[model samples]
Target: MNLRQKIATGAITLCSSTLVLFLGTWEGNGQNTVYADKLARGLPTVCKGITKHTSPDPVVVGDYWSDERCAEVEHLVIEKGQLALADCLTNQAIEQNTFDALTSHGHNFGMPSTCASRAVGLINAGRIADGCRALAKAPDGSPVWSYVTDAQGKKKFVPGLYARRLKEAELCAK
Candidate 1:
């Protein structure tokens, strides 16, 4: 391999590692605290938002996790999420806030859906603020990522999701 190609490969590796780390520390956003599932989804989350979906161990509702345990699980989940999004994330740069925002969104929704979101498109297009805003609301000011369709065949606004999206948008714009 040529020197330039080697350098480029090294740079890409560095960037990918940085992108995987995202906010550096998940606790910076105060999301590391254990949270009981309010939706009765039976998925209580802890450090870096580790839930049953991402946890290797069974995530029980009443289980207590130490800070060390939480951090370990958090790193594991982050790695998993980044791998899941490997092809979806472009070769462009993603700022810390943008990384945090999108990952949180993906955890709440699904990683695949988050990849398909318009926010990802705008972000890849370098319209970062627009992309972040799109996570919370559309141009028409209606909620974008805050509703869930229920078994009753109706869409309902979830206050928790709404708040989380708003927070993500705010952080993403920073």
Candidate 2:
């Protein structure tokens, strides 16, 4: 289901396609089919970024998860990530797009890292738009997180990540 579709999960209202679609589209949106990661983190992933490590059931490279299972797992994982991200936020009541964008960013990055990010710090300081922009670039014209270690133990600039951060920043600014 896309973001246009809403389904109830446990207690999280994360069924909106806005967040799900934003994340799912970037996740290289899949259903039951398990495949390799698009980036260098070669984990076997399924559904909307549900890796074998994140799922309740053991997932191998060739695993075939059910759609119901994928949705359930994705919702649960997203809910957990969002909740964790929310806790790191400040007194500001964030907008839906802000929440979605930050949540997705936290999901891709780590919530702990997101919590300690300059973006979160700016958001805490009531600089929402500035905070959103911080995710894409620092004041010195550099990305906050556009590098990933390659198999050769070298940092590689992931254009996809940089693009996604810009998109997230755009969503947040709106």
Candidate 3:
């Protein structure tokens, strides 16, 4: 090859290598990435103790989670929850508090459900206060009637869930 062509090729290779190295280092550090405190608070409350898997279908429960495992799972959930919220927003800019609240709600309720909720509808329609209020309501659009059948088929109100919904609503309002 000609000298000029060889020099250009070398330059291109160097630039590409530098870019790859920079990205790899940045991603490896993970120090700059900041997850929302509200999300962190809400996730552990709803999911309870940590297990290897996040899905409830398999029903894998464990008494303890290593600190590293917990951190990894939290990061994974936050990443997924953020994507879900972003997709639901569809280019709409929202306050950080609202985003964090909705992200947590979505993480708990499943993103599709949250996306299709009346709260989201109201928010999209420019009724922010109404949307926040709607978020505090039960999934069926009723007041927080926090009751569910236990394993023995008895009903009970879960105070934790009720409080979480209230907190989410408050965050949304902010």
Candidate 4:
């Protein structure tokens, strides 16, 4: 059965308990602090996650994500991440660490790409090791390689994404 069907039929249960487990497994590890610092250092622009260039709640000059906002956004990230996994992962059981790592990757990259990713395919095919390895490498033309124009018109790759991907990969391996 499909995920929604499974949920509806009580074959699969996704609830606050699952969310709590996910939250406990996926620590932010001060990612918000790094994100905020990167934003402040760059040109004034608003971003929801790593890739979103614009957001409804735009962070302007002299603005930073408040502690409450940070928490709220992180919660949203985890929720979205879990939803993505639910839709794509066929495996009934997944390692908590793997789930956490994939959640972080999905949070940054979004559902569409994560859903279509080689990592997801391998994981769904029960090739967990291959999937984790595939996830560790950023493919060509990935947003991680995209450039942002600075005030001087010089374009540079977004800060922190590379490191973040590395961390995600490390987490995936565990």
* C-alpha TM-score for every candidate: 0.70, 0.86, 0.58, 0.57
Top-scoring candidate (lDDT):
2
- lDDT tens digits by residue: candidate 4, 17-89: 5433433343343333323334334534322342233243555554566556655655655565566677788
User: How does residue 14 of candidate 3 score in lDDT?
Assistant: 18
TM-score: the better of candidates 2 and 3: 2
Which wins on lDDT, candidate 1 or candidate 2?
Answer: 2
Can you list the residue pairs that collide in candidate 2? 3-17
How would the candidate models be sorted by TM-score, starting from the highest?
2, 1, 3, 4
How big is the positional error of residue 9 in model 2, measured in Å on the Cα after superposition?
16
lDDT of each: 0.67, 0.76, 0.52, 0.56
Please provide, for model 3 over 150-174, each residue's C-alpha lDDT reduced to its tens digit, 9 standing for 90 to 100: 6566766666656667777887788
Query: Which predicted model would earn the best TM-score?
Result: 2
Task: Name the 10 consecutive residues with the lowest summed lDDT in model 1.
Answer: 11-20
Predicted candidate 1 versus true structure: per-residue lDDT over 3-104, tens digit per residue: 223334653232234333444443233454556654534357665566777789777656677767876776777656755654576635665556657777
Worst 10 residues of 3 by lDDT: 11-20
Which ranges of candidate 2 are over 4 A from the true structure? 1-15
Clash count list over all predictions = 0, 1, 0, 0
lDDT of 2 by residue, 76-169 (tens): 8887777777667763546667778888787777779888989889987888988899989998979868888878888889888899999999
